[model samples]
Target: MSQTIDNRQFRLARRPKGLPERDDFDLVTEPLAEAKDGEVRVAIDYISLDPAMRGWMNAGKSYIKPVGIGEVMRAGAAGTVIDSKHPDFAAGDKVSGNLGVQTHAVFPGDELRKVDTSLADLPVYLGALGMPGMTAYFGTLDVGQLAEGDVVLVSAASGAVGALVGQIAKKKGASRVVGIAGGPEKCRYVVDELGFDGVIDYKNEEINDAVRRECPDGIDLYFDNVGGEILDAALANLRLHARVAICGAISQYNVTGNVGDTGYAPRNYLSLLINRARMEGFIVFDFADRYPEAAREMAAWLSAGELKHREDIVEGFDTFPDTLLKLFTGENFGKLVLAVER
Candidate 1:
């Protein structure tokens, strides 16, 4: 705290119509603030780039409030504490929170969760040990209500949330776990690396046909990350009493106008009625009180090598606008993380 630091941040300049452009944000450098009583100042190390970020840029009623124009862009970030005025946190402690798109930030100590670097890397906290992990955990087990011997299908299978959903399903005794991902490389990773029973390369194959082929007996649980046609494809193959966990709709996140007007809605939804399936959408924060429970199990899986996670690390805080597009473009192989340059 002795030396003055300039904190650079991306503030929302305007609401983006479709995909966010660099102009949508104004990068400003300002003097960093000192931590007040019970507050901590952190030097950000990594920022999470997620599909949900696109939705947050819009102005409307949603799970979370939209980032106001002129406000720092909202983002989940992990960092090392530069200074702390809280009893529990000390300087050099690693932490993660909704720290926004900035090089440094200050927040109440209760708002930041201290992380252990010994168990995992700092970036890993923004991936498997963070919101994405919590989304996959509760989305599969709680919302999807996965059952043993069920045939599970996961859309965006190689993503931060989808990848973990497939693996968690398999570990919980699912008879088969199938993933839907774009491109051959992602398909291979979902199967060869993540241990999914099979994967459909959405880029090469028709999603509906591929879903039917991979899940011939129909899917008992579908954990959907990329909605639209992929969601329709999963819906068409639902088994009796199937459960669908709608974790995200990345395919529709960039719609220019009203989502229902411009986005792709399912055409095969009738299958849900025929199969008596349940489709539910969930926000990870809904299960916030139980985060420690999920973290313990996820950590155990990581320690035992039962779960595998990958982080697509992009260097430089300036790359955030372009980096986030990777999620919609299917360029990121795993969890997309932005490493803030010193």
Candidate 2:
């Protein structure tokens, strides 16, 4: 028998000012249509709420188009297939794709990847074994060009991607791994739990001073997640021929004004020239072709107990708007996933 399910979604009520508010999203329920040829309908289990979503909301030039007014907010999601018309996928198959923020999504079968459930949990596909993990893998290896015995420093050390960056650097034979995170608890987790060589509590200490103390020899590779002042500080402590991977900049996402002047600027531009360092920004989507390769490696590490992942799962689909705010505030402990289904 054919069944109809209620599809609840969070729409952009309006563009945000500073931090996005509840009013910015309008919760609406609709009826989903049946799948056509080459399509698959997903009952989304977990929706990934990332800092990158903030940039997607703004009407500006970016890697992808901004979420238009009254459109469903863009996001990455993992779920199970209830219906399929595509040749590659079948009913009851588990898949992960960018399904936006909704209880159900009908997308082209070619857009989705069938996941192996036995290897890891479903939410891990949205996190450690997913986009965040891939971001850390490619950003550090290709962009940062990390070499053996190089000193690697990561900012936003306890978040999804940052946590993986530190761990991967360690596995690749980094001589020293330093992490900068907000609050004492996260700092402790990065060092004690994640096996980072040192940690800097950014909330309590001056970032520049902390970097100087933790990295006496300067940083060979800097995996920047939280930019702004910390980015500037990292620039001041770059070693000769240092590589800086600009993965994210959550610190300046909510700001309404100009970033170049109002925000913290690196006073060490001269040092970049003198040290012959290179700074490059990359989006994970740029390495989409190599996702399978990266996923294989990350999964092997997870299975071997060499890689660790954490998830901060918030219950209920209705809490999507509120839960997303947690990432900006650092309220989430790990990869933040919104559980839409019971």
* Candidate 1 residue-wise lDDT, 1-342, digit = tens: 379989999999999988889999999999998889999999999999888888888888788888999999999999999999998899999999999999999899999999989999999899899999999999999998888899999988999999999999988889999998888889899999999999999999987788889999999999988878889888888889999888888888887633434478888888889999888988999999999999999999998888899999999889888988888799998999999998
Alpha-carbon RMSD of each model: 1.1, 1.5
Pick out the ten consecutive residues of candidate 2 with the lowest summed lDDT: 257-266
Q: In candidate 1, how many Å is residue 215 off?
A: 0.4
For residues 54-137, what per-residue lDDT tens digits would candidate 2 score against the true structure?
Answer: 888887677888899999999999999999999999989999999999999998999999998898899999999899999999
Which sections of candidate 2 miss by over 4 Å? 257-262
